[model samples]
Target: MSKRKGEISREKILSSAEYLFAANGYHGTTVSQIVREAGLTQAAFYLYFKSKEEILDEIFLNFERQLDQFVETGQQLNQHNFSEVEKHLTQTYIGLFQLFGANKNVIKIVFNEGGQGEKLRRRIVNQIHTNMTQNQSLGILKPEINTEVFAELLVASIERIAIRYGIDEDYSPAYLGHSLAGILFQGVLTKNT
Candidate 1:
């Protein structure tokens, strides 16, 4: 096959797998089903991916690379001012949700059915913990709070909110980000002061 044809077939296979994985769950999806969905033969599917897991991995690898860039950008931020911190965090949340929103089906597959989801979840939590620790050290964040626990809560809350609101609907990402930042900074209860 020509290189162009090969690339087209590869993309078709990936798109088919993504749809099926999202609909049927990963273990329930098979190579034959993917090939049938893609309107390609088993031979053509094999030409692109050695196995279903490879295609899943490829999808997640792209997400992982993007997420890494997000985390790295957050880490490079050195804003000590409270307003700047809130702005950076709001941008971070918006960007993170936008990443998932852009790839909703892939996010569903990985988070619901793939082992890599758990790994990615843990990595994100750890990254949050590390970033919070650094912020406290730099005096950008309060040193009194236990950052490890807070990191876990933050990661879990973001995932829950994204899955609930950001994935399928036209809800505002900016509102979600700003609301989360408010809760993070001020807690749920109104401050008397």
Candidate 2:
């Protein structure tokens, strides 16, 4: 099915706004710049969005929706066995890397911009913490380990790594997934040390 004219125009405006917001920062971008980049007039933009802040809100809403979908589909840490746990973790990380890679621009805007970014980060951390707590209950993760702290660490690490190698294409999603899993599973220090 083809998209309607209005739908196309709305998407154009969104795309243009996202790009500009990422490139110029949310406050730096203007509604005029968005409309100009979208190749639409001010009236056309208003038809889709009320103001510059509204566009940013829309962008964050879209991203949050996607994140919710990813979380829903993202499997919890496996409790069956060590190998299964490792495999599931690797898959989860791969999915996250891909998701973040696809939305690098939005991620940039979220991380660089304040306000909404903190809320988003907290949401992600909470999800991770819940998973960690579940795994801890299942004896997959050590009970002594603080799930809250671990979850925060995981979210921070993943965000930074995704922004770096994930966005820049320095590493493949599969490789990053496996590497992160290995790093998390096995401490960085050598056994001999």
Candidate 3:
């Protein structure tokens, strides 16, 4: 009973913190504000986490959990040609915003509302690195540049595309992801059938 209660309180704190940080960014949102908004005492807040940074790391990690899950699942998905990887990644990127709707809170926290260091970013990047490994093994990804750099660019492109389609409405993340993936694989020039 006590353990369940503690877990509930921690989740409450996390939920409140995710919303606050998502709306305000890491630096802008303070522990006091979180505690106040959560209706939990600072002592209770400290009981769950040592500091705000710890909370940020936890939320950042959790945020990636959903997106990461989709990517990881894609790798295992049985595709004969294996270009399905790109399709899966595009759906995942577009899904990120569509999953949260027009809220933009999650995007704001993860990208625009910045103050996050390389730590959280790299953890997410590490997933891409794993994909890079698979792509190289299968000869899908090129080895010209370092995998890290390429993965970084891939992540950035997806981020930009998501934001563009998410806010602008002129573009669609899903469609754009597929189009970009096709371009990457087939090149800019049209081929004669």
Where does model 3 exceed 4 Å of error?
1-6, 71-79, 82-104, 112-117, 123-130, 141-149, 167-173, 186-193
Displacement of residue 40 (Cα, Å) in model 2 is 0.4
Q: Candidate 2: list runs displaced more than 4 Å.
A: 69-75, 78-82
**Against the correct fold, how does model 1 do in TM-score?**
0.92
Residue-wise lDDT of candidate 3 within 75-177, one digit each (tens)?
A: 6534536656666655665675464345456666777544553555676677777867776777766667477877787767767766676655666556665
Expressed as tens digits, the lDDT of each residue in 1-193 for candidate 2 is: 9999999999999999899999999999998999999999999998977788888888888888877754543234563466776777678789888887898889889888889999888998888778778777877778899989998998888888988899889999889988998999887999899
Structural similarity to truth (TM-score) of each candidate: 0.92, 0.92, 0.67
Candidates sorted by TM-score, descending order?
2, 1, 3
The predicted structure with the larger TM-score, 1 or 3, is 1
lDDT of 1 by residue, 84-162 (tens): 7778878888888888788888888867964689988888878878987887788777789898898789888888888
lDDT of 2 at 15: 93
Q: What is the lDDT of residue 136 in candidate 2?
A: 77
